[model samples]
Structure formats: C-alpha cells, structure tokens
Target: MSVYYFAGASIVAALCIMIVFKIHVDKLKHSPEQMGAILTKFFIGVAFCEVVPILLLVAGFATMQTGLEFNNLLLPLVCIFFSMIIAAVFIFLQTKVDVTQEMRGKVYTFAMIGLSLAISIPFFSLVGLLIQMQ
Candidate 1:
C-alpha cells in the first residue's frame, strides 16, 4: 500500500510537471520547426524525469520479490512506440496542411497530450498496483 502511495504520487507529480510545461509551450505558439525543437527538449527532460520514480518502482518490486522482469516493462515501451508513430503521422500531416503556425502549435499540443498519456499509463499502473497490494 505504501509503495502504491509513492507510485501514485509520482504519477501526479509527473502529470503536473508535464501540464505546466505544456502550458509554457502553449504560450510560445511554436511553428512546426519550433515544435520539433520543443520535442527535443522534452526528450531530454523525460530522461531526467523518469530517474527517481523508476528507482522507487524497482525498489518496491525488489522488496516484494515481485519477479517483475524486463518483459513487464514492455507495455509502456509499446505504448510509447505507438504514440511516437501517431505523432510522426501528425507531423507529416502538418507538412501537408497550409495552416497557420498557431494551428500547428495547437496540433502539436494535442499530439503531445496523447503521447504523454501513452507514456505514463504502465508506469502509473505498476505504482498503483503496488499501492493496492499494501
């Protein structure tokens, strides 16, 4: 149960951080090229972002001898892979659309929301489950 608490807390924290960052990007009204730049920054941030929560998750599993193997991590990896595919399609579409920069910015925002939700699900679920067991 305690592990779940920490896991859920990590989820909420991650979401809050993403939302705040999204809002900041919304203010920028970035063009497609600029959107690419923002995404690059996001990739960098995500690496740093996963560190603590991941460590805690592994620690919880270790304590329980949960036998959660690398295979268990596949769900989230798949989610992210799919999300990236979708985003790539949207970006390609952006090149085709003669839309304003502002519209492209909005599209990028929505696309990222989808991407973030995809990336977060499994990690949060692992945490939630640990919390539930306790």
Candidate 2:
C-alpha cells in the first residue's frame, strides 16, 4: 500500500539525516565551538524541515474544516506544544554533554537520530494525511 511506502520512505529519510549528522560530527572534531555551531544549525535545519510542512498541513486542515471546532485545533496545537518540549529537552541534553569523548559522541549521535526521527515521523504522517485529503 501507499502507506507502507510512505512509512518506509520516512524511515529512510531519517536514517539519511542521521548519517549526515554523524559525518558532520566526525569532521568537526578539532574545534568544539565550530562543532556546537554546526550541530545547532543542523538541528534547526532538521526541525524546520520537519515542522514547517506540518504547520502548513495544519493550516490546510483548518481551512478545510468548516466548523470552528476545538477538536480540530487540538491535534496541531498539542503537536506544537509537545514538539517544543521535546526539542528543549534534546537541546538541554546535547549542551550538557562533552562531545569530545567517544562515548559522548555515540550518545550524541543516538540522540540526534532520535530527535530526527521524532520530528520526521510525525511530519511524514501529517504529509500522508494531507496527501490522502487530496
């Protein structure tokens, strides 16, 4: 089914993003400052890619729904709130770590992967929803 295809594609996309992050982290080994800057920028880029499309989907949903129902707004609002919380927690954890250590590098990689998937999966699902709507 198309749903399976979408899910597989989403996973693949997440994996690719993780691999890129790992590569970047490896390359920026010497300068901690530059590493942090790149990491933050990468995180923001991923978050923007994942969030903006969903927000557009939400807007589309709002427009499509005739009645001004609270329920209609609830899902997107909740997603936005929880995403902010998750992002905050992720950022806090990342900043607390010293990525110079091998263990910490691994931890950071896993954390980045987790964050990427967390953002991507929902965005992809929302995209699927929007596609289905059309």
On lDDT, the candidate that comes out on top is 2
Model 2 residue 31 distance off true place after TM-score fit, in angstroms: 3.3
- Deviation (Å) of 108 in candidate 1: 4.5
lDDT, candidate 1, equals 0.49
Judge candidate 2 against the unseen true structure and give its global Cα lDDT, from 0 to 1: 0.49
Residue range with the least summed lDDT across 10 consecutive positions in model 2: 1-10
Per TM-score, the best of the predicted structures is 1
Model 1, span 1-134: residue lDDT tens:
33443444355435534554554355334444466666666556555555665665665555543444545445543443444454345434543445565576556564565356434644564544443342
- Runs in model 2 deviating more than 4 A are 1-30, 33-67, 99-134
Extract clashing residue pairs from model 2. none
Question: In model 2, what lDDT does residue 98 have?
Answer: 56
Please give the clash total of every predicted structure, in order.
2, 0
Model 1 regions more than 4 Å off? 5-9, 12-16, 27-32, 65-110, 113-124, 127-134
Give the C-alpha miss distance for residue 110 in model 1, angstroms: 5.3
| lDDT of all predictions | 0.49, 0.49
The superposed Cα distance between candidate 1 and the true structure at residue 77, in angstroms, equals 22
